[model samples]
Target: MPLPRLARGASGRPAAAPRVRLPREIKVLLAAAFVIALGYGLVAPVLPQFAASFDVGVAAASVIVSVFAFTRLIFAPTSGSLTARLGERKVYVSGVLIVALSTGACAFAQNYWQLLLYRGLGGIGSTMFTVSAMALLVRLAPPDGRGRVSSAYAGTFLMGGILGPVAGGLLAGWGLRVPFLVYAAALVVAAAVVAVMLREPRNAAGGDGTAASPPMTVREALADGTYRASLVSAFANGWATFGVRMSLIPLFAGAVLLAGPSTAGLALAVFAVGNAAALTFSGRLADTLGRKPMVITGLVVTGLALGAVGFTDNVPLFVVLSVVAGFGSGLLNPSQQAAVADVVGNERNGGKVLATFQMATDAGAILGPVLAGALADRLSYGWAFAATGAILLVSALVWLAFGRETLIREPQLQQRPDGTA
Candidate 1:
């Protein structure tokens, strides 16, 4: 669907806000994202166990997980350059197929090293599709509806993350390798869907319609204060959300709270519940109230709630804090993404810019657990959580002090000659 045009008032200003409608391309991308995330979740729970089955020790098995991320970090820039040269549609399809091949290979691996190599190869493909997808969104998403589009996209991934594990666990009853094959099959379907359905934006092409505009460089993006703030926030988000949440939360629940595995699972689920609830409306708020406010609010709420998680001994309080922190995360993500989209705009490819932004987050996810784990070991869980919260709070302060709002209001949207906004 095309975005609704702003109706004018007697004074020639936009009379009221138009309803947000997503375009067909974004919908297709969302479907693809769901399939990709679900396939990923299918493997996540079983990967370590699968690695251990090859006679590797615990740390070695764990390395299987880390290698994927490490490769993604290193390969991101190459992915960005590929997207710029090949176009998002081509790169996206190829990336999905690469992952499919690697994942399928994982199912037949004869030893730990083979599995490691295949999994590491998947990371290269992972960044290829990831960078391309973000670029496509920047090109295709309507200016007025970027936040809502981002929210919907994120929601699909969350839903898939929730459902994939249950299905994978059931499939695991067949064999550890079954899930890998299933995931590979799912990726193939996703790739087919995108290759068949998604199309590049007309504006992305030159006057001859033979080529795309030059990609926005990392140097250009870095010149913007908002983009810089985005990197900082992205890092903090990775540190707290991806790194600490996955690694430390489970450990803390088990060791510090004296909670069972079930409780830790419940805490994670509650966080998802809270995140889903916020996603329902946060996008619209970001569009209307502005991205900067939502980001700052999310940071404060997440920082305070997540920071408090370690200080409390009560499991109930811990669960409550977890939910609150998730809500804050939901609030922050769409706005942060929309702000970055604003910086990139829709005029040119943001491949390198988006890749750099992704790298910061990936770096945080990689480093946060290591450093935070040390604090947890030498100090205490309280100190670790406190430090995590402090990081978020510090980012919030940065935004409050220097970040600019990136939402383009209805009145501000420029109309093209073709009548599209």
Candidate 2:
């Protein structure tokens, strides 16, 4: 597929600027991402409640949630190796089918142990597809359009995430197991779409069109300062966004603000709204301006806003800060992913490199809550929020000091015969 091109003026002259037009394969990936995220969201809101229904205590029920992330972290290396060996399309399809089977099994679980086992198995599949998907994006995205592609992809998942929970709540009226069945069906549909529509890129060949470049290794990738800095920022992002936001925000809303469940849900919804607003333009800025500036700016904005969140007693102020924090995250994500793509380039497979980066994020998500919760218990919620904010700020400092901009300027980008830049 062709990358984006400059539109022509009325007189057939090239326009002064180029516009990003996503290639067909990326659109396919985006479609599959939406389905996958929507299905996952359907399961997420109800998973704890479903586990509790098995006559388990709160701690045990929460463990069901933790185990999935734990398994994803543990199995990531293996997933990377599989993606490298079998290719992304194969791993992606196989991974989706495995998750589908596991989710369907969850619907039929007769006991807590069964549910736990099924959910844990789903994590293995999650890492498999997640790693392959990143590798595929690295391969397929047009060089100049990587940020825009990442943004569109993230936006689709965000839209699905915003819609899925509401739908899951309605489906729960029917039964908890119904959502699992529905999620399983959604996974099957996503797998079918990708399996049918997405074609794997042929191996990068030499002038003779016979030999392919070797896959990029993690060791080689680590030599780049940008990748190393990205790991720090990725960890901070996982810590603040996935871990603390989900775990701490609701508690703060209920305990500190003395708000109802609806209020807490509203805060989350507003964050998503702010995130959507930023996605509208941040990607284009990243593509046109630079990745480093976006990353640093996002981290600073998120840190400052989130750090102040615990100091505020007013509900309106809390909600506004949440929105600001979400906006910062939206600005950060696409540029971060695009920078990684730049490092990997289009010619070489980077499954292991991508997996290692993913592992850093997963590790932060796994550890952040446990540590922050302890701080909340011993110190205060303020300390927990501040600590998370501090981590983000420190990461921004790392980027400022050491990170390199990875966006390839037009003059520097070289297009191959295959039309890749």
Candidate 3:
């Protein structure tokens, strides 16, 4: 039997859809992310230099390193709530708008505090777009294809991370403020693409079935064990990935590997590439294998690999470790997202839970640079990086010790004759 298109109209009822065929909207969904990444990346390498240009000390420049994360962490939980009240499409678009305006504002800033304000505003946009985009991905996808769907979204960001540095370096060579201009332009392009190409998926709206209502607050989602575990896993992953990679890795490359800034950048890019390549496979793997195993394994191996990266002094060793760490990170996204989807399935509460998860991720992102940089200053980059890895290892073990898989072939978990809550 033939089925309806993946994106049905305004009605919330998802019509029966056919077996796996990638929807057109997938490209639309991933489009804004590329623009966002490019703009952020263009200025990323030299943000400290920009602050320093204003006569600020290294300590003040650190805000350029951390404000983005701080703002995101604060706003992530709110994304879902806002989206549920609105809709995924509006939230996603609004986010792009915010980033565009914020970047434009940054380009004109002449002082340290002005730049800080702009960067913080951009974080709000990032959170708004991410939470809604993710919720939409969950809703649009068929149950069987959830992993790949998320893998595609995750992969987009990964690819963006790859391109950001190469682009950032070249643009930074041109001018301190050119990157911001480039970011604004790229965002315009992304906004256009999403608007023209993407069509909203109606079925994934709100919570549960048409009869059910989405939770009004983030507090509601936290009360559930399954949701809570997913948040913890995401936070652990983000802390290890974002915190260590941006803050401590470059130092490790220069000090231990005897490399330069470019080498350090390449090492970071390798991590993104590794995760992106893995996404090509992990999506299908998640469908066949399920989500928790992938999340647990990703957490464990990433930690171990970070420890190895810290321990090694050789350039070749760092490269290999970057690839492995990225693969581990690649595993965490789809599995954790799928778990969120399992609980959020057929529920409009997608916005609420997605927001909560983003907060966890944001918290990690916020903590990563500041905390890692602090540790590096006090102790060593190796210690700063390794500690995050160790944290992941412990977090993974906790999940495996007590957490159970959220989704198994739906048939196996179907309710039996007995009434058990």
> TM-score for every candidate vs. truth?
0.93, 0.93, 0.84
Query: Residue-wise lDDT of candidate 3 within 1-421, one digit each (tens)?
Result: 1211223224543232234787777767777676676567678777888888999898899878688878877887677678887778888888888988898888799888999999899989888988888877877777767887788777777677667867888988888888888888788778778867876555434235555454445566666566777777777777878766776788778877789998887787788877887888787666666677788888887889987787786888888999899888888888778778766774454887787787787687767767877877898777877778878888787777655665544332234579553
Please rank every candidate by TM-score, starting with the best.
Answer: 2, 1, 3
Q: Rate the local accuracy (lDDT) of all candidates.
A: 0.89, 0.89, 0.76
Candidate 3 contains a number of clashing pairs equal to: 10
Model 2: worst 10 consecutive residues (lDDT sum): 1-10
- Model 2 lDDT, residue 191, Cα: 95
lDDT score for candidate 1 against the true structure: 0.89
Clashes of each: 0, 0, 10
Give me the runs in candidate 2 sitting further than 4 Å from their true place: 1-17, 206-208, 412-421
Candidate 1 residue 55 C-alpha distance from true site, Å: 2.0
TM-score of 3: 0.84
Q: Cα lDDT of model 2 overall?
A: 0.89
Per-residue C-alpha lDDT of model 1 across residues 340-374, encoded as one tens digit per residue: 99899998988889999999999999999999999
Give the lDDT of residue 339 in candidate 2.
88
- Where is model 1 more than 4 Å wrong at Cα? 1-16, 208-212, 412-421
User: How many backbone clashes can be found in candidate 2?
Assistant: 0
